[model samples]
Target chain A: MTDVLELRDVHRTHGDGANAVQALRGVTLTVRPGELVAIMGPSGSGKSTLLNLAGGLDRPTGGEVLVEGASLGTLSHRRLSAVRRRTIGYVFQDFNLLPSLTAAENVALPLELDGKSIRAARRAALAALTEVDLADLAHRFPDEMSGGQQQRVAIARALVGERRLVLADEPTGALDSQTGEAVLRVLRERVDAGAAGLLVTHEARHAGWADRVIFLRDGVIIDSSGPLGSADDLLERTS
Target chain B: MSIRHGLLALLERGPMYGYQLRAAFEESVGGTWSLNIGQVYTTLSRLERDEFVLPLPENDGGQRPYEITGTGRAELARWFATPIERTDRPRDELAIKLALAMTTPGVDVAAVVQSQRTAGVRALQEYTRLKTRQDKQAQDDLSWLLVLDAMIFQCEAEIRWLDHCEATILRRTRTARPAEQAQTPEPHPVRKEARR
Candidate 1:
């Protein structure tokens, strides 16, 4: 069990004045290599706040976030940015895409920003698109593509940089059940390829597909269960 | 053993109808495995069609007896020797709704959670009443009263879980997923309407 990410006594507060809201409270978590974890919580339980801190997108009010032995709390902004670019991939519920860019261009953006050659980035981007079965839509812009297609493109972008860590916030939240299942299969394949990923979702079916699921409440984690082998396990765990 | 083979193995002891066969199954397996009577009957019909079992001549006593044929015994032996692969996965609906509620927009996930919680409370109250009645009659039928107790406990556990889910829903308002909401716009209205 090699941990790729770990959070200890993590806390996030929105304000310091009289109107402060504590999103996370002394929360602790860990994600191992090749593990697909689903963090489930009702709204306001600090799920996204925890994700933001873990991904280095936001600073936590307290606690330590260790990514590959390097504490995010100890890293400089530049160092964090570097870690984000190379070690992590993010997929949001909204297919965040540049409407002006094609699917291939969107995928290539990360590699290009990291100083890769345009030709090389484009080639890798195409390969990633193919993995999600959307190579033919590589030239399609976000507006031209269907919601599912756009999400698949987002997935390709996440998988493009050979990132070892993927963070998806409701990746299938925008698709129909059938399409959602298809999108989930891509994430499962990435895990099979040895990437450590954390999926934040409310859907038990999506959580059922993960290696493990953590239920959160009031900024704390509850039942932490095994590689959910089946849907029955999902219902059983919840019950 | 495949379920069918397990059934044949049970039937080999004696001719039995669906309910009797079910009881024999539970006793043989120490009640660890529960089979739906529907599944047993469906398999029995299949076995009869395959000539592994035959419908014995109808008795004037108005009971159907199923006797395993020689071929059925051989087939049952082979089945018992081969482990059956488990292929079906259970689907959890509550998890699906919560996930969608977080990502899907403009729709009140909390309201739906409350609705379910209310229904669960009603069901729990009904189960409590039934359990009380059964307890009072336990002296008349202890065995059935015990079965009712198990069912009541299951229903109570379900209600507790539903209450927990509702409490969680009430405690937080996850920031709406802008990207997910924008892309989805509305939860496939068709599915939502159909569900309603």
Candidate 2:
């Protein structure tokens, strides 16, 4: 099967000339259906840049990024936005829910924007919320929910339309431990059901949820290891 | 350390043979702590010697059963009521290693902290994997999940501590070097004067 997300020797740089900052250098990764890959590194090690490139939110300076066998670079702006809307789901550290929208409305926004009927979008949103155990709170606005609950809604939104690729950046950064674990459980369940996921986190315990871990250093892919592999040597050098 | 109390707690339910007690103890703790039959028997013997348990008549197969005494019940109650003191915990080897590394000359302290952090992360991953494999019966598997959570939390705390150690070390060395140089006379001149 084609990978849900693939990055081949991806390079991303900001600015130009001698002053240009290479945010990502020669990083190659793939996330197939049912695989969850974690990107981990120190601050400013290009974790976020890699995620942006994968999501098509930012263009790579070199190499290719493909989603489900289609090259993102070749897509027109309208087509790229459509692909992002229909194929990708993103969960940020902050919930990023619109305060004016109720949970279900927030969740259904993506589907509606993609031109699904409002009724169909709402139905899908309710189904997604039920998957995350938040159906009861569908009518509640973002301000009415706790941080964890809000994050659950965000996850519900991400998974609403059968999006195959989920990208999360420190999705549990703001929550307490128990709440964080609860959110992670929802994320894990979705990925296990065949969604490919790419999570960027500084917390190793959070990365523990991933099937494999990619370690970055100075914009380069330094090491890749299984969840149980000994990281002492790599950690020593990085630390 | 809690094995003695664990056995007594299991016995509180009813009289149990050594093997039964071992199985019950392991089950109650979610099978994370495995108690050998020999260890169970030894603990039972000690409890009997202390009058915390009484040995009943042997069954046809010669399996000996033991029942908790009133004293044992009271002791178990007290154990439940009391808070575990920090001093009672074993010395933290990681903390000791970091402390020593801080003072040792020519030692790469950051490297030591990093190695420990990596090991801690590995352990956290193992615990998480174990948790994932567990049955989804939250009510029935609560004990095991709690034990796993404890390990995960401890590993996370260790990693945070290691990061803190590295940062503090860097900050101190950056700020302390000039002060030390100004305070101490050149060692070479002092050695020469002493030799003369």
Candidate 3:
């Protein structure tokens, strides 16, 4: 299987000398196409840092972070941004929607930023929204929707560009259990559609959605256990 | 006793509200396990769904009280007699993190140990304060209080272990330490000569 994301000896550090905080220390990991991997750790354990590096939002201080054999560190800022726009999709914890814009408009923002025609962007956004079963609510603003509805819109936006990899950071943290489960169902559908997903979550229940769960701590993967026969298998093993 | 079975046995006496059941549980058990409100409600709902218990009609339109059904009594009896399967292995994330952090280069094991100790100390102090306040209440629920005591003791033990781990790491790193140097045993002459 072709790897969508690969990290080799990746190191990210904050500060210098005695005051240094090594967020990632010689971390090596990989995510393949159609694979859903959840990175779990306590606060400040560098789970978010790894996601940022993988998505090309931040460069590794040392070593390589490659997406489809393209080295992220070697890409120029403009090139990296373009690659992010065209190939990488991001779903964040806070939804990060425009209150004035409708659900369809928010999902269309990626295409709009990519300089696609307005009509084309709107049509594609509609189709994306329909996939999440939120097409009827496309005209509704973020403030008018529930937490689950807003998250679904964010997910549709992430899937709009046909991006191979989607990076989600605490995607379900803001919603109730039922709503969170619904949103996760949409992400799983996306994965089944051949898109790789890297989910950063603290909740083991949400991580249950992924194909594999990577246990990260202090900026490195400590252990990983996954590809279980079923969700109950995961719950049993972890519980 | 199983938590669900214990709850059913208490409710078998009579239908009672959430707080009343909690109070009864504390009195009977001498306050060992602290049942959070969330856990109680969730268990009640599951039991009701399973037909082991059912909610009785409320009096004066107040909170609903639960009553144990005949099925619940039978289930409770079976639970007391039979042991549930508990083959699952516990995965402690913090321990695993510390284990890996100790092996990884460039990261200071002592710093990791110190930070965990600091956090544990803070948690222990906060838990102690809460315990003091909980103890002074007119209706002090000793059941949950006892649970908190166990948690506090566990935290103290972890902090001590972390201190020892830090000391060991520091001592190992120190130059001219005989034990540290001795760990890398001198190669046997016969085995060493095989390379040449």
* Top candidate (lDDT): 2
TM-score (second chain) of model 3: 0.62
Model 2: per-residue Cα lDDT over A1-239, one tens digit each: 78999999999999999999999989888999998888877788999999999999999999999999999999999999998998999999999999999999999999999999999999999999999999999999999999999999999988889799999989999999889988888998999999999999988789778877777767998666565544333323322
Instruction: List per-prediction Cα lDDT, in the order shown.
Output: 0.77, 0.86, 0.79
lDDT of 3: 0.79
Tens digit per residue, CA lDDT, model 1, B67-125: 99999999878877766555443556776876787688887765666555434433333
Q: What DockQ does every candidate get?
A: 0.03, 0.19, 0.03
Regions of candidate 1 where Cα sits further than 4 Å from its true position: A228-239, B1-165, B168-196
| TM-score, candidate number 1 | 0.59
Worst 10 residues of 1 chain A by lDDT: A228-237
Q: Write the per-residue lDDT of candidate 2 for residues B117-150, one digit (tens) a residue.
A: 6666666666776787774646568776787777
Error of 3 at A20 (Å): 1.9
Candidate 3 lDDT over residue span B54-171, tens digit each: 8988878587899998899998888778765544435666779899997798877756775665455445444544454465673567566666656666766776677567556665
Report the candidate with higher lDDT, 2 versus 3.
2
Return the DockQ of model 3: 0.03
Q: What is the C-alpha RMSD of each candidate to the true structure, in Å?
A: 17.0, 6.3, 15.6
**What TM-score would chain A of each candidate receive against the reference chain A?**
0.93, 0.94, 0.94
Q: Which portions of model 2 miss their true places by more than 4 Å? A: A15-21, A229-239, B85-88, B95-116, B135-138, B169-196
Evaluate chain B of model 1: give its TM-score: 0.50
In terms of lDDT, model 2 sits at 0.86
TM-score (0 to 1) of chain B for each candidate: 0.50, 0.85, 0.62
